[model samples]
Target: MRRVALLAVAAPLLLVACSGDSDKGITVRAAQVATVSEIVDAPATVTARAMATVTSPADGRVASLLVKDGEGVNAGTVLAVVDSPSAQQRLAQARQAAAATSTGAVRIPRVNLAGTQAQTDGAAAAAFAQSQAAIAQIPDPAARARAQTQLAASRAQYAATQAQARDAVRQFDAGLAGLGTALRSLTAAQGVQAQAAVAAAQATVAALTLRSPIKGTVQLGGTSAGASGNLSDLLGSLPGGGAGAAGAAGAAGAAGGAGTPAPSAAGGAAGAATPSLITPGALVGQGTAVATIIDVSALGLQADVDETDILLVKPGVRAKVELDAVPGATYEAAVAAVDLSPTTSSRGGVSYHVRLTLGAGRDTAGAVVATPRPGMSAVAHLLVRTARDAVAVRASAVVRVGSRNAVWVVQGGTARQRYVTVGTQGEDLVAILAGVRAGERVVVTGAERVHAGQKL
Candidate 1:
């Protein structure tokens, strides 16, 4: 009775296993003889490739805030205006100095060097003629003596003339060199003054108009320390102080003062350059970073990659990114860079920030086609490993025994369990390093149900 009962249960189980159900398959073909691309998937992000910050390059009073936040701006657009009358005045003074130096009176000294040379030359000629006459009057016996004396006198006169001419020439050349030197010195001084004028003018211009250096979105920030008001007065006045003195009024005004604008171009602006995107009445100051203009044309996705998986990522490797906020949309990308250093977030968690560059794929029709903003979550699949023309089996077909993995091979109507050393694999296929060959049948569908020596 017990045997009959066992047979009854066994028969139904056998029939059920042999029936045409999904679990009935017990044969496996060779793992597809194609190259299997191994991939690693992780989260990623989209961000601008370049970002610019607009700040006060000078310190002065804010006369006008030309742009507001969230507004798009182009390069060289005036964003704000600062008052710098003092700088303008200084520039005007410098310009006046330069003009005076340029148009200054010229002085020329009178020196008759040519007349002096002519007088010396005539004296020398008369002296030569007298010496020659003396030589001709000498007798034949005293001719030698007369010739020698005349020669001496003639040489002396010639030497005096040469000396006079040399002195005149030297004086003339020296005067010319001195005049040139003086003119050059004046010119150089004027040039220095002109440069100062230009600098002052540039400073005034810069103070008058705040411009954007790049095309992007705007931002805002606080006022400068000097422009904030006197700290002592502020402290003394606190909420209330002196009656109605200018000091008291000035102190109160300073306390409630709208912060000063950036300095003249000569000096950097003390206030922030108004970003077209920012609203008015925003406080800003010198050395304060007010706005960031981001270039969003080429998008980049930043992702945190596990240290273990980072080895598989290389620059230029293909990747598929899926944003959590945008459903049914996937962006094709490539590994732009792999950050070797791990950074800790505010939460004290360490992560490697990997940057992925998006490919040239656009979705023009969808309602959500608008570009994704920063802080969006994304998943990235990176190719890690691949195998070609190698034996593979479904992950389900692999079984673990002790420390080794085993799979059941069906050959000649018998089921045999064989150990395999695995390599790379995918969702449904595992690369077989040993114990299996291409085109050989293995249990794929009923991997969990099959055992060694089990009847077919």
Candidate 2:
């Protein structure tokens, strides 16, 4: 029954870890009652906390190289200088424009128009009291009542008239102030635009002195190391590489808009062979790769899980990772976050992105192993669901026949097809909810190829 709940969230793919043995090309194993767990196998990539790439802000030649590749430098350290005359000229022009729009000498006018509604309300009340007093001598009840009602109606009309007048006066005053407000708004807008242009020009000029966005060891002219994110992080977060522990990547990005491109682009820089143009007096273009800083203090993992299985994988779920480069080693990690947006591939398959904090790694003998380098290919086996004491069979025995799952059961030397409802699926075993019973010999391998009523 517990396995039934996992059917909707479990992905069709079986990646559960288990042990199995096959006797022949067509092996049949007796269905046994065992525990099985559903797994969401996702491909993951090692990502750094931050890999800030520094680039030239303008098209100019390198005037000086302050830091060499592979040197440890502090944040805001000047790495290189590009002497761009155009950048300086733009700064001068922006300053002039800003000075022209300064409104210090001109005053912003104030407007106040007192309304007559209050005075009219008081006068109308006094006049109504005088009318009532004048009518009190009419002792005839019916005539007096009619006279009072008439006075009330007249008073109401006078009240409405005064309200209308007040509204008119308000509209007139607003019209008079419209020109003043327009003038103030125009002046403010001009000043804001001028200041923004000046700031941009100043940023460009300052970028000429390329500064290290973070405190880290620099990598000389080599392939621009990609930032600390997997392809999934690149798609989902798109900034600061993938977010990790503190002191990882914050410094790699910017010193409050110093004109350096976001660190994400650093991972897309030139090759390992330092560009010959990086030396002093070499010409370079705008946004040219200058250097990179890799923060090794922290690392993260980005995994892509199929849309069908993502729901079961949540924050804090544990995962065992296997890297292609580090064979026979398993790493421990836990889910940090799951991306709300889905990443659709060209093949039309949709998957949700997940981020995890990388932990330690162990080898086949349970000995500690070295950590994997960033951008390493890895497979994450996320334990999403588990079923215990269920009717289990070899995973290979189950075959998808159109909309249903079935197995080829060998009964008295004859093989027959039996449809079954499955629960949690594992690598070597699958938990069956119904149809095939325990001790039934089912074809584990070649189940898809076998026909019903075939002689075994």
The number of the candidate with the highest lDDT is: 2
Q: Model 1 — which ten-residue stretch has the worst lDDT?
A: 1-10
For residues 383-438, write the lDDT of model 1, one tens digit per residue. 66767665666677788889999988777766789999887767666778888876
Question: Cα-based RMSD of the predictions, in order?
Answer: 25.5, 21.4
Q: In model 2, where do residues sit more than 4 Å from their true spots?
A: 1-30, 97-196, 220-258, 264-276, 346-348, 365-367, 396-420, 434-456
Query: Candidate 2 has what TM-score?
Result: 0.56
Model 2: which residue pairs collide? 16-427, 48-228, 69-220, 221-274, 222-271, 222-272, 223-271, 223-272, 226-267
lDDT of 2 at 419: 95
Q: Where does candidate 1 stray beyond 4 Å?
A: 1-30, 55-61, 66-78, 81-215, 219-281, 285-289, 344-351, 362-369, 388-390, 401-404, 445-452
Per-residue lDDT of candidate 2, residues 1-456 (tens digit)? 011223222322223332223332577767776667777888888876666667655555689998877788887788888786655655566566557658343333333323233433453454445335423322222333554566566555555555554554466576743444433443443344344344444445555777776777787432434222232421342223334211101111111121343444212222233443467875555445667766655667888888777889889988888999999999998999898988984357998878988888999899999987677888888888788767788778888889999998889978899999998877667889999877778888877567777777
Query: Of the candidates shown, which would achieve the greatest TM-score relative to the real structure?
Result: 2
- Give the Å shift of residue 114 in candidate 2: 34
Error of 2 at 358 (Å): 2.5
Clashes of each: 40, 9
Cα error, candidate 2, residue 452 (Å): 11
Poorest lDDT segment (10 consecutive residues) of candidate 2: 247-256
